[model samples]
Target chain A: MQTMVETRNLRKTYSRPDGSTIEAVKGVNLEIQQGEIFSLLGPNGAGKTTTISMISGLVEPTEGDATIGGFSITKQSMEAKRLMGFVPQEIALYPELSARQNLAFFGRMYGMGGKALRRRVDELLEFVDLADRQNDRIDTFSGGMKRRVNIAAGLLNSPPLVYMDEPTVGIDPQNRRRVLDTVKLLRDEHNMTVLYTTHLMEEAQELSDRVAIMDHGEIIAMGTQDELTQQVGEEDRLEFTIGAQEIAEAVFERIQGETPGVTRILFNPPEQLDEDSSVFAPALLTVFAKRGRTALPQILQELDSAGVEIQSVAVREPDLEAVFLALTGRALRD
Target chain B: MRSILTIILNDLQIFFSQRGNLPGLLVIPVLLTLVVGWSIGQIGGGGPTRLRVDLIDLDQSGMSAQLIEDLRAANDTLVLCPLDNDAEDFCRLDDEPLPLERAIERARTGRTSALIVIPAGYATALENFERVVIDYYSLSDPLQPGLVLQSLNAVLQRASTASMIPGVAGALLDNVISAAQLPPLEGETRDGFLRALYLRSQQLLTERPSPVSFRVADSDGSSGSVLDNGFSQSAPGMGSLYVMFTVLGGMSVLLRERRQWTLQRLMALPITRAQILGAKIGVYFTLGIVQYAIVFAVGAAVGMEFGSSPIAFLAVMAAFVLCITALTFALAPWIKSEGQANGLVLLLSLSLAPLGGAWWPLEIVPEFMQTIGHISPVAWAMDAFHDLILYNGGFRDVLPEVGVLLATAAVLFAVGIRGFRYE
Candidate 1:
């Protein structure tokens, strides 16, 4: 397959008002093949947006460069931008304008006009299942409806490459699922390359053909689901939620040694829910074991004997979340 | 270029689509033009009211008739009582001759505004180029001349100047002949030659049109008819004020666009940043011109004069609109919130509009205030409009005002384009 996008040591540094410098993207390198869905998965503030912005030519990189279809984004921006569509995280549309109007305008910006632009707008509206609401002002539509139109605007030019920066952000779950399916449809039916950025591990797991796991402006891992999970040694994650209480650190060590098949253990103490709230959230204990289901009862009994009050228990298979935790020593949601 | 036009069209469509914007863009401006125009007309001595000035020509000479004609020409508002008198048939020969004393009594009692008495021998005095004392009788105070007295004085000054020119020229001719040691001509022949020379000189002065002229209407001496000068001043004034209102309102819209990320999306397109900036600027500029057109259309409907040069009028409109558009863009980047942008728009428009003499003529203000008012672009635009509307001036007359506005626009555009926020 031909590479659709390639980055070389891409970096972005921001200068604070006080003259301090902070690196948002640190010497990142990436390659995405045509007709594949590539995901940049990370927590909030992990430089996902900055990277996408640089690639989309919305922002300039401090150092290095990115090329779309062998056209350097910074050097040949107009040519490179013509080949790709960018769907920003915000609605990024004129709310007073109808969806069809917005689509036609963006289509014209891409050099499409006349009946061709109109036809493309109609087709995209229908594809997004928003044809009935195409004539309504975007401000009058629901959040999910607006998001669909935003996605449709990106597809107006029929570009081979599209960059979607958290397209599912702030929408209902059903709409988010619909957007995911539409993303899949783009790759499956149109054979278009997609670069999707999200902080949700589940979304990246479900949609990406290949994933680059980023943390603190660095991509710590990149591989298929199996390849990434294998790095954590085939272990499953066993989680125990306990009532708010203090527990000795020795309890986790004792439980890990006594529970069969258990390889490692991590625990989190109770936390305050909010600034004004007096209630404390349940503490969590996560155990990594070769066979999580078999070891759950033993781990629960060991915690029970240690005088730990258990609230709930769950056994999770090794997935992106576990991969992220294993590599970064932090939960994906953290 | 096509992309820029498309962006401009899209922005305009969106702007017009909002029903809330229509009142500010169209209705209020038109309404204000009419209201303000009529109000100023009333303030300007009740809308072209004609002053009734009675004329009692005891001399009944051709010179006295000519003087009456000159007064009639000087001010349309001067209603010569005998020429326009109709109620009691007082000017008819069948009725008893209205005496000069009665006319003066009528003027003093305010039945007529003023009375001019041309005594006997007026024609002989004028023919011989001798000094003539023409009595001007009026109830108006000499310190504060009424419209009738002012018109009378203006015509008399021209007459006196014409009369003096012949005597001066004849004396100079006589001196020249005597200096050359030529024999002095006998009385009849010399007088005839001097008389012909004076007639020719008077004709030459009368043929040349006055550089300054007024366009007041002659009323029936009851009260003034509705004057168009009020609308003439109000149309451009209110139009410019509303232009500032409409164009500066773009600051808030632009901030909202940035917050919505539509501006960022445009930057990500194939179009260059310059194209997007130009398109945005074009949108507000077009709207400003449209706003002016609406107000001026109202002015036209109500009989307002657009001066002798329509193209210069359009230039003034264009320059002012461009300047305001630049101001909008220059301030848009520093606005942090839509609310702040809204407040700033109101503050700038309200303050600048009044400061620039949009509410009244700069001529009415103090010289120091007028100098300070020119700091506002609205003042420059209003000054150009006044030249076109009030002075009957052409393009050349308004070049300085237009140049000032255009230069200000250029400087503002430089700052706006340089500091523009593309992302």
Candidate 2:
């Protein structure tokens, strides 16, 4: 497949009010191919938005360039932008205008006009299932409705490549499912390239053709789901919810030594709920095993002999969450 | 360019569509223009009219009485206090006897436009061709011509010319008698001839234009247009005030646009930053022009003169609007919230409007204050408007004012474009 988007050592440095500098995106590089749904997964404040902002020409890179369809975003921004569309995280539409008016205005901004602009606006309203409410003011719409119209606005010019930055944020489950389906349709039916940024692991797992795990301004891992999950060596993860008191180091060593197929055991201490409360949240004990379901009975017997109280437990999962944990020694959210 | 215009049209549509903005743009300003336009007429006449002059006739002779009558004829607007009494004590006297000392104080304090005091022996001194004294007192600036003083001067000049005519005629008769070696003529014939000569001279002087004629001229020595029912004062004055209110209001809208991220979204399009900035500027400029147009339309209805050059009138309006639009952009980036921007709009519009002589002529303010009033761009605009509306100036007369406005606009545009936040 032809490369649809490329960035070379893209960096962004912001100056603080007190004259200090913080590097938000440091010398990052990426290549997204045509017709691929590439996802950048990272927790909040991980610089995923910043990198995508530079690539979309919404922000000027401190150093480096992004090329879209053989056009440099920095040097040939107009041409680069002509072949792309952007749906920012915010609802980014005029609240006073009707949904149709907002779509028509943005369509004109992308150089469409007259009947063509009107037709495209009508088509997008239908595509988003908002044709009935197209003439209603955007401010009067629900959060989900606004998000739908926002997506419709971004696709006004029918660009080949589109960037969606957390398009489903702050919406209900139904809207999230709909947004996911919309992304699938973009690639499956239209053969369009998509650069999607999200913090949710489930969203990446369900929609991405390729995934890049970003943390603190750098890409830590990249590849298909199968190729990436293999890094954890096929060990199904086991989770144990215990009482407030955690097992001691000796107990942990004993469990790892005696339990067959148990590769590693990790214990987390209880966490205080708040300053006003004496209640502490339950501690957690995670044990990774090759055959986690077969090994669960032995792991429980070891904990029972040590006089430990277990609240609940889960058997197995070798997914992106496990991959992120294995690679960074922390959960995706952490 | 089409994109720029499209953006401008969109913004204007948004601005006009809001129901809350109508009063400021249309209803309030038009009503204020009518109020201000008529209020000035109440203070004075339709234009520059009557000034009160207090006269004390100490001589009480025919000559002094004649001087008083001549003063009235010289300028009908000079209403002599006490002699020409009315219910309104325009002379500022509290019905007290106007002793010479009290009258002097009135002139000194500007309670009256001026005071003319004739000495007790003025008529006798004038007839004998001896030195005559007339005390003229006022608090008016000597540099600016005082109309009351001119009226008094014309009366005094006629009196002096009358006194000299007799002396010159008497000398000429004596010279003719000596040269011809003839007997002396009778005193009756000689006195009658001199008296006849004085009467004819007075008639000729009266027939000619008075030295104190109220024909106002420009600094360039051109005749001026008269004010029509005070619209000259109110039309441009209120027009400028409303222009500030309308244009500075853009600050809040610009801030709201940024907060809503509509401005940021525009940057993601194929449009250039220059186009966006140009369109934003154009929106405010067009609104300002429309604001002026509305008020001036009322002015036209009320029969206000726009001087000789409509083109210069338009140039003044356009330049002023551009300067204000630039001002709106230059200050927009510093505003953190829509409320702050709204507060700033009110503060600037109200304060700058009055400071720049939109409420009244800067000439009425103190000299130092007039200099400071120019700090507001409205002052430059008002100056240009005054040149055209009040002074009957053409395009050339307003160039300096228009140039200042445009130059200021360019500087502000540089600052605004440099500091404008797109995201």
Candidate 3:
């Protein structure tokens, strides 16, 4: 597989009033393959825009080098830029001009003209689902419609590599879904390589072929979903409250028998549930079913006979949000 | 290049699509021309002040009354308002010697153009060839002050000649002087001698005579059409004043293109940042030309003669527009907000027009102001236009103005290129 974009030890330092410097991007080394969708996930102020700007040739990196489609970002800027398209976090469109006109203008800047230019403009408008509103002025458009047009303009020249920074931000759910589906179509139909950045964990997981989790300007983890989760090992996280050592032992056996691949089970009691064997009551049966609750008198009777009286129950598993929390130690938005 | 054409098409589209902007851009210039044209005709080169004349007769005699009637018969250009007063009632807007102080004050305040005081026996003076010792008063602004004096002079000349005609003069001088040397003979020759003598002298002139003539012309004419003169000069100055609007509007392209992310997106494309800047500058320069054409049309419709040489006016206006266009591109990139651009445009427009002689003619302004006017492009443009229109100057007269404007445009273009940014 060919590397469409590669960053080698890229570092950016910003000086502060105290004469100290901030390392916004510290020695970031990455490679993205052609035709692959890559997502970079980070919270606010995590140097996302700065990194993207360097890659897109909008900002000059203080150190290291990036190559886009074999063109060096610093040394061959025009070529690098020519190979890529950028959609910024903020929606950028001319409010005074019609949507179609905006696309046509940008297309022409890339040396497009005549019938070819017109065809490209039409295709982009249709691609973004803005064909019907092509004649409407952007100022008259809804926020979502404007954003779609912004995306369409970015695609006017049909560059093979694309960078989208928070493309779904501030959009309604229906529009968001449409934009996401369109992105999928771009990848599936055009074989376009995309570098998608967002703080939304679910979106990143859904869209990215390879996810890179960055925090405080540093990528702490990067891999496929399974590969990254596997770093946490056989960790289908399990937990239950227990009132007695005897009941805890019995609950452990039940969990071991019910769920395959169950490796380690731990019994812990909350400070408030002390001396109550009923704490492991309902939870003991849940382990066997692996469901929140099984509405059955038989199960309840069995738990009572087994001396596992119900008080409280809780179970945990390793999902994307959990994995992210484990790595960053904070919520994605923060 | 292609981008330039696209940008022009975009501007034209917006201009046509947006009805509100069209009225101010196109309709107002036409309307200004029509309104100002009609008004100029009504005022007749003077602006808009009517003529007022006051006759103060101290001679309550029949001849003095006849003199007043002749004064009233002249024409509509002069409004003869008669004032009567005792010495005690002098300052009351009525009465005669017309109170020297009151009459002077009334003329100064524009209540009367001139006061005709029939001094004690001003009629008797005419009867004796002692001279009709009439007193006159007038203010300074009227270009027609001479007209006022001329009318009063005509009335007095007629009255004096009337008192001297036929037997009236012959009866008094009949015993003392010969009849062959006497001026003329007529019936009530006292009544019409003045009118006939004035008429006969008018007929013998080798030169075509104006309605009123004197040995020495009055330097101050009547204040007939003051605003007309002001508006003519003011309209051209407004050309300079409103040029800033184009500059402001041109600079708006930066924020607009930047906001649209067009700049950023363009940079990402195969093009250079310079290409984008070139396109915008090209577009706004075109806008500046459009603005100049509109203002020129307005000035022309108002009957402001730019000059016999159309090339000179076009060259000067083109140079000025280019300089402003370059200035717009240079300054626009540095300004971060639309409000700041607006404030700069307004401040520059207001201050530059006055300095450049748009508010009034530099001839009436002080020498120091005239020198200062050279600092603004508008000043150069006005000088060039003045040479062309007022002086009827040829292309050579406008060459220096064009040179300076071109230099300014070049400098601004260099500076603008230096300041441009892509994101």
Alpha carbon lDDT of each predicted model: 0.84, 0.84, 0.67
Tens-place lDDT digits, model 1, residues A221-258: 99888899889988889888888887888888877788
Tens digit per residue, CA lDDT, model 2, B40-157: 6555433434566789999999778888888888887777987886664444455777899877876775546788899999987877567888898886676664778877777788
DockQ for all models, in order? 0.77, 0.57, 0.38
Clashing pairs in 2: none
Worst 10 residues of 2 chain A by lDDT: A325-334
lDDT tens per residue, model 1, B1-423: 999899999899988888999999888988888888887776672232455567878788766787787777778766676776656332221244567777766656444567888888877776677888878876558998766777777777766666676678778878988999898876888888777876776677577764333455443433222357678778888999999999999998888888899999999899888898889999999999999999999989988878667898899999999999989988887888988988998899898988898888776678789789988999999878876665445676678888988898899888888988766
TM-score of candidate 3 relative to the true fold: 0.64
Pick by TM-score: 2 or 3, better one: 2
Q: What is the DockQ of the complex in model 2? A: 0.57
Q: For candidate 3, lDDT tens digit of each residue in A142-215?
A: 87888788788777768788899888889899988888887787799999999998888788878888988887
What value does the lDDT take at residue A141 in candidate 2? 99
Worst 10 residues of 1 chain B by lDDT: B88-97
lDDT of 3: 0.67
Best by DockQ: 1
Q: Give candidate 3 misplaced runs (Cα > 4 Å).
A: A11-23, A233-316, A319-324, B28-235
